[model samples]
Target chain A: MAETPIRFGILGCAHIAQTVSRAICLSPNSTLYAVGSRSFEKAKKFSEANGFPPSAKIYGSYEALLDDPDVDVVYVPLPTSLHLRWVVLAAEKKKHVLLEKPVALNVAELDEMIKACEVNGVQFMDGTMWMHHPRTTKMEEIIYDPERFGNIKTVHSIFSYGGGDDFLRNNIRVKPDLDGLGALGDAGWYCIRAILWAAEYELPKTVTALREPVLNEAGVILACGSSLQWEDGKTATFHCSFLANLAMDITVLGTTGTLHVHDFVIPHEENTASFLAAAKTGYWELVTGMSAIPSQHVITTDLPQEVYMVTEFSRLVKSIKDGGSKPEGKWPSISRKTQLVVDAVKASIENGFEPVQVRV
Target chain B: MAETPIRFGILGCAHIAQTVSRAICLSPNSTLYAVGSRSFEKAKKFSEANGFPPSAKIYGSYEALLDDPDVDVVYVPLPTSLHLRWVVLAAEKKKHVLLEKPVALNVAELDEMIKACEVNGVQFMDGTMWMHHPRTTKMEEIIYDPERFGNIKTVHSIFSYGGGDDFLRNNIRVKPDLDGLGALGDAGWYCIRAILWAAEYELPKTVTALREPVLNEAGVILACGSSLQWEDGKTATFHCSFLANLAMDITVLGTTGTLHVHDFVIPHEENTASFLAAAKTGYWELVTGMSAIPSQHVITTDLPQEVYMVTEFSRLVKSIKDGGSKPEGKWPSISRKTQLVVDAVKASIENGFEPVQVRV
Candidate 1:
């Protein structure tokens, strides 16, 4: 017997929507059932340009797409400022929500969306695609093994891309009404998540923003960095910028080992990724060289990470719709934790770079 | 006929002295002429174990070794506390000085040593061996290329080694009266140098030590980190610890290029080293992957970095002794700058983690 694929309806034709639309088509347990935009012409064009099935529906308004009874899930790729409204409405319509990152303008708004999803009994997961990659899983296996990695003492992450002068002046990300957080919300989201993920999702005791964050005239952060410290002496630092060249890095140092990955947010290749790990590393005789070098581990996947994310989200949606199971709490919990740290960092920046306690 | 090699005298027989002794023997322009310790038997044993030539002299006391008119240079491997006394004495005796890192207890002490060397017309070079590596020069060339690397934005460096329980309890680095700066002086020195090297030796405007520094009972810093901010908005962060695995890394992010070197302090292979550089990197279509991966550049050398250090120092010494040229000021200037930053970080930590202005 074959299980029916979950039907997906995408809200807004944002640039990222095109990628998620393709992911829905590629995921084995999901189908791109519909797409919605402000105008019928735009929706129709998106549907035709992407490989949407001929039977897929196109709606002129997001409301019409959410009203469709056949849509079991809605992937929201709207700007961050619109997330609270669209995500809550989709949950009210009993549609599983796969929201893009920088989940909301702040944690308070995200809490409303999460509450709506819980009350409606629909799964909710953010669109952090790299979390589903097989390479992330492989690295996790080594880091989690005490004998292999020991206790993680510190971490450093960087995610930055050189957005041209035009982007600095005109990109939606730099606009206050759009993605407002700018570099901190876009590129920095990945770095923050990387640090928290390296810490096994443990929230830090305090967050302190570093000095000299570059800001646009509209007061959106163009570049910034922060340090996180835990009560048990664990610490981490991260940098994110829209002014530097494309660089995605994560370095985790443990009591007896270290892990390094240069392309943590997006792999350089679609189907393959690699990470370096060293356990019990030491120096050679006379301290002239390393006793053993870090070994590189390559992970291969049949599908891109976005598709894996879609497949996983759909699998959870199927259990709720067909098997009468409850929504998984892990995804939403992780999202809220990341947002909490994000909020703390912003508060520290606003508070004159003082250390801000991370509240629950 | 080949010009006469610079005759070298070593003070103390610390473990590092063995490595530097080997380097002196290997360098073409340096010769292991004499060694000294508190006891003549220990000096004789060290000379025999370190492959000194048959004509090598052994002295019961450091003062005796420094008094030898034939010894053109003295390599001081004594503890930080003894550096001021021994280095000043060596300089006054007309011997060029190759002082081990953490050159002095503080900038003031370092200034005294430098002044002594300057007044006596003797070369002064700190034994930061990696600075002499060919790989270091290759990395510098790339980072300094404005067309390729653009403006430097941020840097992160880490140098850590897990010293085990016994080392944590008994090592001289953890003893306040000996290497009082502990990991900051030993491992952190390299990280600071790396950050400065990335910035082309521009001093930061201020420094703020991160919270939760691990300190020994004697108040020696075992693990710590700091964030440095430049007047022009450039920033750098570094971490050094005796509690983590052996990890030496330097990541430099620029406006148009990125540089990463995992084994910046000590190469994995003595004969070869490598670093990754990416210029004009961007995302692929749909933001699925990178447009181009970073290129790996491998630099090979015929001599070990420590040997190169000895050769370079000896070259300067020979130039002063034989060519009638004054000692090069570049080496002392760099060493002083590095010490100044080290002093600032320590001051920041002592001052309740507040930002401390870096006074030149």
Candidate 2:
């Protein structure tokens, strides 16, 4: 028997919601049934332009969307400062949530979200699309094989992008109160998540951080470094910068050898296109070889092959409908850990880049 | 007129003295004029075996050697624990001093040494041989060119060697109170010094360090990581380990590209007899190309390359004799900075690897 598609209602007409909506439309067992935005005109336009079915609905406000019985799940794509409020509301409405990256701004907010989900008996998962990528699985396989990679000694990860002057204005990225965290929260979160996930989500024994502040007439950290360690003696160092130009790379050093994965966050458009073409043609070798080349030339051409976030969301909906326990041991925990790390970064910045012990 | 060679004195008959003594013999404008050891028999044996000129004197003790007016400069290669005391004594005696690597156990001791040198009106330089190597100068030139290498973003350095269990027994390296600083201060000094020198000896604005203690009969650090920042917003990081097998390499990442120099601390040995014959017969290109390939198939050999420390010491002697200030920008200040960094590592270890501000 064919499985019924899970219906999704996006809580905000955020720019990220477009990515999620596209993913839902393309997913084998998911549908973008509705959308809600503070502005009624924006919601209606989003629904119309995205080709929502006649049965699909548009709501002027988030609460009205949550009240809709047809919506089985909610995709929360709100500002970092606003995540906790909508996430709890969505969970209270008994809708499974795929909250956007950085589950919440801090551990306290995350704890509240988790509690609300538990009390309402709803599944809560973070939208960490990279975890679902086949390449990440392959990385785990290679790193765990003692004969292949050996014990990891050090991990150096970097994620940066040139956010020119225009990038700082009219975006949540540069808003000190709304975003709270800057480059470290936006891009650096991915690198930190990848490391902790690869290290089996082990809580660091100690953490020391440094920050570079690019304030908006008001002082706040706009960039930073968060260095961490495991009790068994492994070091994780991450560099997060906003003033610097675009660069996203991760390098892990082990006792036997090293492994590097370039463009770990947002892969090149060409790589994705080629990957999809090869996937359609059953040419796995060509896809793998294309991925192996580290040059930007190949990556820039290949990355647009698939919509990573939508694909992961589709899987989450299927898992929930099948009554499986929330894609056990995956994105939820990873995203929570990522939020904790960001919280630590903020604490360190507040204390003048001092070492802050992460509380799991 | 040709400059007069600086007459040098040996303060101890240690293995390091043998290397220095050989370098002095090979230098064009330097000579070993006096030998000193706690044992008269050992001093006489060393003088006779090394063919010290008949007019050269031997001293039964360090004080007697300092009393000899002919001994214009003293090379002190005592154990790590004794470096401070003897350096101070040599400065008080008004003898130009070249102290061995790891100028002192910590910043406090280094400050004392610096103060002593200033008050006594004598020249003092740390014996960090790599800083004087022409290859190192070439590396600095390449890394600092903004058009060529651009701004450096990351520095990864490693130096490790394996030693037998018996080697740890009775060695100062294994004694925390004697060596005071373990692998980090003993061998990792070069790795830190290399980064600072390559970065034009910029003082880091912030530092985060992690250390691992190796347990034998007593606990000693075996590995460490340091993240540093320059005032101009450039950041650098380094790791050092001694528990691993023999390996020494340094890699720098810049905005434009990456550069790596392998086997940086030591060059591969060359067979002098075969090389001399090949050169005389005009087989230079073929022989040199074959030798350039790094592999186990090549035979171990030695080259007639210039001795790094001896050449630098000769230049320092000339600078002093010419009545000019010591080389304005040299390795001593860099060495002091590195010592301060290592001391922070020690403090971090004591405080459970918490972030400590470097005071240098």
Candidate 3:
């Protein structure tokens, strides 16, 4: 084992930062190194409340944390509107980025962040924690199995939460200047990522926005959906909202099999996650019911998925630090593809729900 | 109790009739009274093979069964193209109609059939057996309970079954003049009905067909989908296909709760059905996972859902016969509403995937 842990510095006191803070503490290869907020006193309070070690630094500004030589990685949990500026600056300071989702306002902004990380030789990975879960790897194995899954024919994903009157009116996500894409960027980001993940990151040929996307008074999307069609004739549809009950579903249907994960964004249990799969299932005699039932597969981990994400990021950062290995290309490649689909969907919604081609 | 059981006369030897035939035998309030086919030998074989009693009649022509005074209900399982002619004739003979769905190729045809039933004082119900499942009632109780489900916001239903090469080329559903609308009228009919049922029979204001529907060479839709928007901002989307794995899903999201039924079309087991419901579910502390997991509720019945459908149809007929009641209006009304949505989806698909207003 390495003597020094990859040090993590948090950029904000955002709600999601608390989760990442716990994960950084749980990861054996990483440590909570610092936290920065606009107010030094607020940063101190947050650090104390979240179990920061005595040696961890506290800074009054994000720039202060970026300038700290001890901070090897910065987990950016700021709003999408602030991601481009902070992430690029952090990369210029040679800090690896494990950025929160809806990484930027648009693909152009995300491209700039990616280039910054590339220029500085720092790793870039989105904070989609579910992708790091062991269950996700198991699901990918089944989806790619030629004998069982066959060719994927259709995919449907939904990620939504009832953002009550308070969040709808007061949250930064609903404000046009804060998270301009609104629910499409917040809840929708996971759905798009799930679709791209199931399709093996092969970009769709065209994406058409579903009609009547619900938008707030500030023209921020409150709820929206889109359909994507691939050149191989595979298709997908996803719905995201801030106005419905909490639901996270990813149902993928291949010609001979199906995969259903009701709580795909987050598992019901932290230690174990499960998914249902049916391969070559059939109907009962006379069609009274199904002949073979779907089998539930459970995957267990020693740590939560967020911890796994931190550990993975720290592993890459360590490789770059001690092993002289180049940064991993898989993480940012998938993130860029997911963001490309998001851009295409937004374009379709803006251009009167027309079909917009997805360009890499 | 009425001394006489409702006698069911089946028209045509369609494969679906085999399931309904078993249902008729299992239903306590009904009996398989007769069968008709274009050939006498075929009618005799169908009657003998499907548990028809020794006294049951076999007719060479459908008109012969319709004219029989002993047949109180005619279960029409003929191809959809023949429904307009045979259903009108059966209703004219004062027979209750347990018609297979889609009840007609279009709502106009369905309206004609409904008028014929009303003029003759005969009850009319479609063969959507899942609606009669005890589990369905339980689901409605939760979805309708104000404290549990709250106001409905969005719904999604998917019903798809993969069709092999032989099925695609040879099935009556693929023949233009036989089933005409193909999978849309077959599988999509169930999806539309489920959406209407969840929304309490309220028709959507606009229906837009998803683009790039897969169609056969004869111009029959093999796979299709649509999005519906209600005037009150309630929305629904459904996908029906003959090119994916068999999947029957109905996921409803209310303001405070969610309801999920994976095998909504047919239960995975003959003796029981289940659904999952989560009310006011929340995230766990630190956002590790769901705070409250959804609980599975199972309902068991001695008879299959198809038998329950037959028993319910017979009860309605017996009410008109024994209780001196007019034919119940509920069945035809819901059937018409389902057909209206089906018609709207079909029109939208035909009209360049435009948003067509549902004219109820």
Best by TM-score: 1
The TM-score measured for candidate 2 stands at: 0.66
TM-score of chain A of 3: 0.98
Which numbered prediction scores highest in lDDT against the true structure? Answer: 1
True contacts kept of 1: 0.89
lDDT of 1 by residue, A1-360 (tens): 878999999898888888888898999999999999999999999999989999999999999999999999999988899999999999999999999999988999999999999999999999999999989999999887888889999999999999999989888889999998889889889999999999999999999999889998889999999999998899999999999999999999999889999999989988899999999988888988887589999998888899999999999999888889999999999999999988988999999999999998
Evaluated at residue A215, the lDDT of candidate 3 is 94
Q: Which sequence of candidate numbers ranks them by DockQ, best first?
A: 1, 3, 2
* A305-330: candidate 2 lDDT, tens digit per residue: 13455555656666755766553445
| Candidate 3 Cα RMSD (Å) | 1.2
Write down the TM-score for model 1: 0.99
Per-residue CA lDDT of candidate 3, range B288-317, in tens? 888657789999899899999999999999
In angstroms, give how far residue B205 of model 3 lies from its true place.
0.4
lDDT of 1 at A209: 94
Model 3, C-alpha of A38: deviation from truth (Å): 1.4
Name model 1 segments beyond 4 Å from true: none
